[model samples]
Target: DMNDIPPVFTTVPRPITLDDDVPIGTTVINLVAQDSDGTSPNNQ
Candidate 1:
């Protein structure tokens, strides 16, 4: 998985309220990221 990610990405803390209660087996990642490619990733 590390090889699939870029090295120039930066991320900061950004928390969001749960849209809905997740199931027991669910996995979630809540983060705000900024990439050198000029795209912004939100609440991932």
Candidate 2:
């Protein structure tokens, strides 16, 4: 049996404009990913 499963992203990421003087710790985007295999931790 194989324990390896690929991850999937249900939500699509949006594009945003950023300033050239943006801070170092600034967050551009937050992507949401999911796993089809419910048995794997990636789904959590």
Candidate 3:
């Protein structure tokens, strides 16, 4: 019944090195997150 806990990021993106030639709108890194409340949607 204690589902008031807030969502937290389980894993975050680390420092990344990109080339100067990198194009725009390119994904640099991906972030991962999760929620403990089973009743609430996994909307991290």
Against the reference, the lDDT scores of all candidates come to 0.47, 0.71, 0.72
From the highest lDDT down, the ranking of the candidates is: 3, 2, 1
In candidate 1, clashing pairs total 0
Q: What is the lDDT of residue 16 in candidate 1?
A: 57
**What lDDT is reached at residue 34 by model 2?**
65
Best by lDDT: 3
* lDDT (tens digit, per residue) of candidate 1 on 1-44: 12334534356655756657677766566455543433334212
Candidate 3 TM-score over all chains jointly: 0.50
- lDDT per residue as tens, model 3, 1-44: 35566777778757899999999999888877776766635333
Per-prediction TM-score to the true structure, in the order listed: 0.28, 0.54, 0.50
Question: Which residue pairs does candidate 3 place in steric collision?
Answer: none
Q: Predictions ranked by TM-score, top down?
A: 2, 3, 1
- Give the Å shift of residue 31 in candidate 3: 0.2
lDDT of 2 at 19: 96
> Best by TM-score, which number?
2
For candidate 1, what is the TM-score?
Answer: 0.28
lDDT of candidate 3 at residue 25, scale 0 to 100: 96
How close to the true structure is residue 31 of candidate 3, measured as C-alpha lDDT? 79
